[model samples]
Every structure is written in C-alpha cells, then in structure tokens.
Target: MEFYKLKANPKRLFLLDGSGALVSAFFLGLVLPSFGPLCGMPKNVLYLLSVIACIFALYSFACYFFLRRNRKPFLRGIALANLSYCFLTIALLCRYSQSLTIFGWTYFGLELFIIGILIRFELKYASVR
Candidate 1:
C-alpha cells in the first residue's frame, strides 16, 4: 500500500505500528534471546528491548482501538517512541559491537531501516491536517 494515501485514514498507522512492535517484541523477547550466542546481545538486554516493544505495541493498539479523534498527538507519540527505540538499538549495537556477530548486525540494521521508514510515515501523516 502506498503510504501517502494514509493521509485520508491515519488510524491505519496504528495498526501497522502495533503489528511491527508485536513482531519486534516476539523476536527480541523470544527468538533472538534463544540464539544469544549467534546474536551476541545479552539475553537480559534483549528482554529489556522486548519489554519496551511490548509497551509500544500496547500504546499503538490502544490508540487504534479507543481513540475516536484527535490522533495526531498519539501518532507522533509512537513515532517518537520508535525513534527512541532505534537510538537505543544503535547504542546497544555500538556497545556490543565486539561481541555482535554478522547476524546481529544484519538484524538490527534491517530493523532500524524498517522502523525509520515507519517513523517517516507516522510523522508525515500526523503532520497532515
């Protein structure tokens, strides 16, 4: 779907954000932690990231379901949260660069790229009248 069309119905952004956060939570909380040796991120750190993702998911989903109007602030809120997540991921990546394997680098790089796109969409749509 062309995201530019989302200006007409911005609530869909919440669904997209919530779904992405849910996936991030699952991977960070479960899948990646189990493969800690390969990913090279500490399990506790992975779990911490997962918990943050879960919170983001809840906020997005809540806004998607309950907020009937005035969603701009909420959309921006999630966009900011996602941006923060990217920063945290970058910090973790730098801190763990020595231990992080190719897979870890690739995973986080892809995740940041994807979330960056989502943040752009969210911010763009939120700015629309």
Candidate 2:
C-alpha cells in the first residue's frame, strides 16, 4: 500500500482507465455523431458532445503520461477527473433513458465498479506521510 507499490503497479489501473477514457472519447467523437442522429439529438448538441469528448480524451492522455511519471498530484488529479466524468455519464444516462436497457445498466455498473476500484487503489497507495 505504499506509494512506491502503487506507483509500481499503477499500470493495471492506469491502462484500464486510460483505455476506457479513450474508448469513451472515441465513441463520443466518432461513433456518437452518427448515433446521435439516430438518437434524435440535434446537430448542435452532437457537436457539443463531440467537443466534450475530445477534451476528455486529451485529459485522459495527459493523465496517462502523468501517471507514467508516478507523480502523486497527477495520480490524484486523474482520479478526480475520472470520477467526475463517471458521475456525469451516469447522470446523462439516467436523464436520457426512457427505460434503462441491458447495455445501459451494464455500462453504468462497469463505470461504477471501475470508480470504486480506483478509489480503493488511490487510498491504499496514497502517501501516508
């Protein structure tokens, strides 16, 4: 649970999060544009979502490199940022869905699970001193 241990083993969590972020970004950036049209969201809203996704992707990439450096602040920042995104995603899903589909529920569950794991990892590995 030492900082060094967390720093050393951070790859698993980092890759998990970074990959998720990248995938989310890609969906929002590329796939969502088409999906949005089908989903009935306006072009303006779709563009806004795409912009947001691009920003999230950039942030995720930054966190990936920062975590690679093993800097405590960057680790903390990444956790916070991802947590925020998870919450926002959940809220969006709930707001948008008329009735939750299996896919929606599964995605929400996975996001929450990952957030919980990241929280535990952060606490366990955070510098005590």
Candidate 3:
C-alpha cells in the first residue's frame, strides 16, 4: 500500500474521491436512468443513489478545499459513508435480485468492488499519523 504518498498529501485523496463520486452521480442519476429496462433497477432507486453520491462528492470537495488539517475524521466519515452505500446496494441487490438483469448485477458488483478498494485506501490512510 503506497500510503506514504497519501500521507504526504492527503488532499489528493479528497480530489480522487470527489471526482469518483461525481462520476457515480452522473452515471446513476443521468446515464443509468435511460437504461432502466436493461439494468432492471428502478429509476427512483438509481436517482436516490445518485443523490447520495452527489452528497459524498460535495463533502469530499469541501474537505479538499477547506480542510487545512485534521482530516482523519473526514476520511473516516467518507469511508463509513462508502461502507453504508455498499450495504445499501447489497440490500437493494437482494431485494431486486429477481428483477435485476445480468447487466445490473454486473454493474452494481463492479461498483461495490471499486468502492471497496477506495474504502480500504481511505481507512488505511486515515489511520496513519
């Protein structure tokens, strides 16, 4: 884990997280809705997820710009938020498993995997001095 680089400049983490969250919001809120039938996830649920992503993005961006120090709490906050999102997604997946298409499963699975990786980095760096 190249936490040394992150420790040197934790601001970069906020940027990366914010950017990823924006992408998630865009896809979930705008792009995915058009493919609802193929994805087999409701539009409302996707929009809700997108809204959450937007909130995450806002928090990350705010931290990046405004936080001069004491970032551990914010980092943990995002990590926890990401964990909560993963759990919510898992629950949704289970609830909609019967209706969710292969594409939906694949998409959500990839999202979970990616976020899980990010969460690991966030948590690890948050623990460092």
Candidate 3 local lDDT, 41-127, one digit each (tens): 999999999999999999999999999989999999999999999999999999989989999989899999989988999999898
Q: Model 1 scores what on Cα lDDT?
A: 0.93
- As for lDDT, the candidate ahead, 2 or 3, is 3
Question: For candidate 1, lDDT tens digit of each residue in 1-129?
Answer: 477667777899999999999999999999998876999989999999999999999999999999999999999999999999999999999998999999999999999999999999999888887
TM-score of each: 0.97, 0.59, 0.95
9, model 2: CA deviation in Å?
5.0
TM-score of 1: 0.97
User: How are the candidates ranked when ordered by TM-score, highest leading?
Assistant: 1, 3, 2
Output the better candidate (2/3) by TM-score.
3
Each candidate's root-mean-square deviation in Å? 0.8, 4.6, 1.2
Ranking, lDDT, top scorer first:
1, 3, 2
lDDT of 2 by residue, 2-60 (tens): 44665666655555556666665565556646654354334454455556546655665
Q: What is the RMSD of candidate 3?
A: 1.2
